[model samples]
Target chain A: MGRFVIRRLLQAIPVLLGTTFLIFAIVYALPGDPIQALAGERRVDPILAATLREQFHLNDPLIVRYGYYLRDIVSGNFGTTFRGLPVSTIFEGKFAVTLKLATTALLFEAVIGIGLGLWAALRRGRWEDKAILAFTLLLVSIPTLVSGFVLQLVLGVQLKTSLGIAFFPVAGVQDGIRSYLLPGFVLATVSIAYLTRLTRTSLMETLRADYVRTAVAKGMPRSRVLGRHALRNSLIPLVTYLGADLGALMGGAVITETIFNLPGIGQQLFTSVYLRENPVVVGIVTVLVLIYIVANLVVDLLYAVLDPRIRYE
Target chain B: MKNPSIDTHPPADEVAQEPLLVVDNLHVEFATRQGVVRAVNGVSYTVNAGESLAVLGESGSGKSVTAQAIMGILDMPPARIPKGEVRFRGTDVLQLSEQARGQIRGQRIAMIFQDALSALNPVFTVGWQIGEMFRVHRGMSRRDANNKAVELMDRVRIPAARQRVNDYPHQFSGGMRQRIMIAMAIALDPEVLIADEPTTALDVTVQAQIMDLLAELQRESNMGLILITHDLGVVADVADKIAVMYAGRIVEHALVHDIYKNPAHPYSKGLLDSIPRVDMKGQELYAIKGLPPNLLNMPPGCAFHPRCPYGRPNCVTDVPPLYEISGTRGSACHYYREVLDGTVQ
Candidate 1:
């Protein structure tokens, strides 16, 4: 196990390097000069612009710029933003919020989705299964932005209008759990639909396996047969999907965060890109990529725990 | 070793008089996308206590379906027993409530499947699953159940019962896993043990060992054993009575020795002739021509007439009921006497 973990850690180094390099190249390749954009169209001397370019090392070749970027990252100098603020400070604050939102949304989706999935699979061909299928289809078909807007309107506008008071906050995270509920649920809604469908299908297939029949023949209680035997085996496919989709969700959060006006790294990156700020966008994107890589590593390790057939080596 | 005293409470003759399990006119059909396919058609048989009945048939002959129907394990939508009565100990198991049926499943009757490895859960230890029967049915505490589970493992002759009890199903060999399955089935000392092709998946040596173990265990417990298989050789020493099923119906039923020596039905004779024997060296083994009839649209009269070499014109137009040829033998054919006397041949 130790050897396996070491191998996985070593493997991750190249992945991190490759992703960081790709993001660096793509960000640098974007049109418009960062220094020129930052200075705006004020009547400034060309020499002053040249001096600013030289100071920022913008005069260097692309490879030299990449080398400097890698060196600064290694030296704990994430570089100053176009506004001259520390990149780390901006990232740390916004990342904390994004992490909290994503974690809450993931937890909510996993619980509700898995629970509903088990219920639906057990009650297959019944009205409850149909109802869950309909609700999940509706949730998955609608765009995230539309879901966020509709939820805001229904829970935010309609409730406040009818009840003469707001039961759910319209936007922003505050007021403890209540503040996080609407936006968190909006993000979780679509994910829940996807996860529930996956869980139900996998569980149904697992329940039909020969081992399940054997367990029943052993006179195991229906609940234990379903929970202990069927559920655990069914989770293998579901876990794979969850692991693969984590990166996509992190990328998708930008849209969801914008629609709901949540203060997360996604919103920060959006604003930074609009302002043509290089440091914050590059830093956040690199960190998010690192997070995705780490999540996949954790999932790979977790696979061994879930299935006995998987040897670490 | 001292001679073990036989169980005398249930008198041998009286026990034979009472049926431990009766499957009456069972008709199981599956509703496919195309149409309804009849899997088991009007199949009926009875098992007496302390007796081993072998339901012999080839693959796709509804042998396993009949066993599953008795166990109440058939999925209802696809597999519906349209007409049947599975009476266990004078109670109709099919009509029983799910809870009541579950109560009787492992405690009164148990089953061992063909593939031992696939039948056992890969994640859990074999001992834990075996102990589950006691825990679920008898409500034994975990520690007590574990001890009894070890005892069962030892009874089935699984080596190092104490240490190996903690091992998962995959840790054991194929033969050992089958022993574990047997251990689980006999854990609760069920009255009827249904072993569906118990040794079909094992080597000849392991097959002999499993059969020996089953016979020894059955004698000790005096339990009714129903051996479902296609191999006649495997049942030679174990089965007391043999029921030959062909295309969802029993074509012949008789004492094991009697059927082997003088098979009354043409299909049964063909099955016996098909088995390669040590005495028949260099001779081409007999093969039953054509496949079993399609249940959806079987032949009008006899299901086996199409495959029977001695089939007559009347065999295709008249369905022969199971008729008694002697005091202990029965055959479902109109020309049983003529076939037995070699007149038809």
Candidate 2:
């Protein structure tokens, strides 16, 4: 198992390099000059622009610039923006905020999704099942952009002012962990819907399996039959989805972060892309790619744990 | 060969005692979108302690469904008992509360299925699954249960029982897996063991081995055994009596030897003739004509009339009741005399 993990880690190096290079090339190819944009509608002195370009290797070919970026990356240097702020420095606390938000979203997705799914599966063809199916459909239909703003208005703004409940802050991370609740739910909304449906289908299928019938014949109570015999098999697919979705929640937080005004890496990523900060953009993407690879590896390892038929070797 | 030692019945006084299990006038139905499927209609049979009764039928004959109904494991939303009693030692288990029925299920009346691969939980070790019978029913410690599991595995003749006990169901061969299933079913020393097509999924050689193992185990424990199968060949040596089912009802009931030598029902004769024989090498094997009737839309009258060679006009309009051929035999056919006397024409 250890060898399998090590081999997987070794295989990830090429993936990391390929993805980072693609992002680097794409950002370099975007129309518009970052140096020219830096002057912002005013005419920049040609000599000063030339000196800045030379320092930042703006005249170098894409391959040479990428080589320099790789070298610096290897040496623990993520490079600097036009404002002379290091990319790593910009990422320092913001990554933690994004992590917190992603974790919160994941927790919400798991608890509510699996709970609703089990309920729906067990009560299949009943009113409760129909109600849960309808609710998940509604969640899936609404996009995060709409859900984030709408929830903010009702729960954060309206309730705080009219009811004087002060239930949640309208914006920003001033209230620490409490501030992430609204945005986290908004980020998790669609995922929660998909997961609930998957859970329902998986649990329903497992419950019908011949082994489950044997469990029943073994005289196991309904609860033990479901909890022990059915639930373990049902959880395999859900774990795979949740593990991969962790990286997605972290990377896909742009809209939610913007609406809630949380100073997370997602907000930084949006700003950096607009300002054409190639180094910051590429650095953040590299970290995300690494995170994605690690998450997938963990998911693969978890498969061996959940199913005895699957072996890493 | 039928072993005479195991074939011995109890003394005359106990012969009159209540049989171990009785499934009387049992009806099982499924509510489907197409219509209500009457899967089992008034099927009745009795199994005595220290005896084996084989319920013979092809697929969809409600043999397995009858077994599931007895176990109280039928999913009731779609499956409704609606009628009949499953009496174990004179108690109607169908009337008992689910909790009470559950207590009787594994501890008193255990069951094994045909496909051992799907029947055994894949993720758990064989030891854990076998040990579960003890842990859940007897409240044994994990270690004690595991030790008991190993002992049971050995009893079922699983090679290297101690080493193989920790392996998953997928790791075992088909024969070995079935042995594990048998071990698990018999772990609690239940008075009755219901095996549904237990040897159907196994190869011929392995099938013989498994049947032998079951018979040997039955002889040792003297538990009443209900062997449900489609194969007439597998039942000859193991089962003392046979109940052949057609559609959802028992069409024939007799001693195994009587059914083999001369079947009173044409359907039973048809089944016996279908088996290939060296003496009839040049002739094409006889097949019972037509398929079993659809449960949703069964043909009126005798369910087997369409397939019976001697099917007559009344056979089309009148359902045949089980007529007593002798004190210990019955056949659900209007012309049992003609079929038995070879006067069908």
Candidate 3:
């Protein structure tokens, strides 16, 4: 397992390098010049502009500039923004909030998604299953941004309007568990639908498996047969979906972060894209890609735990 | 060595003296979109302790369904037992509540299935599955249950069972996986074991080995063994008595030797003749001429009449009652006298 982890981590090095290079190239090719944009429509000497370009390595060929960016990033130097603030510093504060939001949302997805899915499968072809199936379809059909706004309007504004209470957690609490709930739930909506669907389908198939019948023939209590035999077997596909979702969710947090007004990498990257901030964008993108790789590695290792038949060399 | 203390409840042994299982006129029908499909119709048989009863027939002949009904594992709505009584000793299992029947299942009359690869849960170790039988029924702790699982695996003659106890079902070969399944079924030392085509998925050599293992285990426990299969050759030696089914009814029932020597029903004779003999090398292998009747659209009279060599106009018009050939046998063909008296051959 240790060797596997090392190998996976080693593999991520090249992916990280490639992602940084490609993203840096894309950001470099953007129409706006960062130094001139930083000059902000105000008059400046050509010498000052030249000096700024040289300082940032912008005057060099794109390849040379990318080489420097890669080296600086490798050495843990994300380089300073044009405003003179370190990109690392900006990301550090924001990464924590996004992590909290993403993790909370993931927790919500796991609990509600798996629970509803299992319940729906147990009650398959019944009213409960139909209701959940319809509810999840509606959830999936609605666009994420729209759902976010609608949730904000209802849970944030109308809950206070109708209930006469501070229903929005963010109102009083800041960066706490309660504060994360509204945004986290909003973020979890699409994933919950996906997870519920995944869980239900996998569980339905697993429930019908011959092994489940064997367990039943073993005279196992109906609950244990479903819980231990069926549920565990079904969890394999669900776990795969979950890990991939989480990996993707690390970067996919942009809209959710923006909607909730959370200062995370997603929001930071979003705001920086408009300003054409290369270093900050590449840094955040690189971190999220690395995070995604790590999440997949965890998922791979978890497979051995979930299923004994899947042994790593 | 690990008996699992079946004597934990006294009288379970005394209860076995009457008969391990008795299925009386079991009628299992599946309600489908088109109509009610008759799966097991008026099937009756008895299995005694320390005896093996092989319910033999071609596919869709209701042998497995009858076994499922007796085990109370048949899915309802799709499958309904309109009229039946599965008597375990004296009590009718069909009349019992689901919970009461569950206690009787793995604890009293366990079952093994064909295709061990699919039957054993892929995620769990063989020991864990075997241990589960103990853990759930006896409320054994994880450590004790695991130890018990290893013991069961070892008893089933799995080589180096201690090391292999943690191995998943996929790690084992076909025959070894079947052994693991048998181990799980016998974990509780149940009074009866219904093996539904248990050797069908195995090769000839592995099939023989599995049958041998089953016979050995049955001897050790004196358990009533219901070996369900379509292959006459596979069960000839293992089964003390054979019940040949046509469609959903038992067309013939007799001691294995008597049935093999003088099959009372034409269907039974046809089945026995289809067994390819080494002495008859290069001779055309005989196969029963017609297809088994579809339950949804069964023929009006004897389901096997269309395929029977001795079939006549009367046979096509009538469903023959099982004729009493002797004290120990019955045949369901109208022309049983010629078939039994060696005049037909």
Winning model by TM-score: 2
Model 2 Cα lDDT, one tens digit per residue, B1-345: 122222223345544675778899999999999999999999999999999999999899999999999999899979999899887766678877787788788878999999999999998999999999899889999999999999999999998999988899999999999999999999989899999999999999999999999999999999999999999999999999999999999999999999999999998998899998899999988999899999999999999988888889999999999999998899999999998888987
| Candidate 3 lDDT by residue in tens digits, A1-313 | 6776677778878887887788888888889778877877887688988888788888799899888877887898988888789988888778888888889889999999999998998899899999999999998898879988888888888888889776575332373787788888888898999899889999999988999999989999998988789988899988888888886777888888877788777878888988878788888888887788778878878886888766644
lDDT digits (tens) for residues B13-79 of candidate 3? 6565647688999999999999999998899999999999999998999999999998888888689
Docking class of 3: medium
What lDDT score is found at residue B210 in candidate 2?
A: 99
Query: Per-residue lDDT of B161-195 in model 1, one digit per residue for the tens?
Result: 99998888878898999999999999989999999
Q: Give model 1's docking category.
A: medium
Q: What is the interface RMSD of each candidate, in Å?
A: 1.1, 0.6, 0.8
Candidate 2: give the clashing pairs: none
Clashing pairs in 1: none
lDDT winner, 1 or 3: 3
lDDT of 1 by residue, A1-313 (tens): 6776788889999998888888888888889878778767765578877887887788898778878888998888788887678898887757777776777787778898888998999999899999999989988999888988998999988999998788788877776567667777777888899999988899999998888998888777788888898988898877776776666666668877887677888888888888788777888888888889888888877776777666423
Give the local distance difference test score of model 2. 0.91
- Best-performing candidate as measured by DockQ: 2
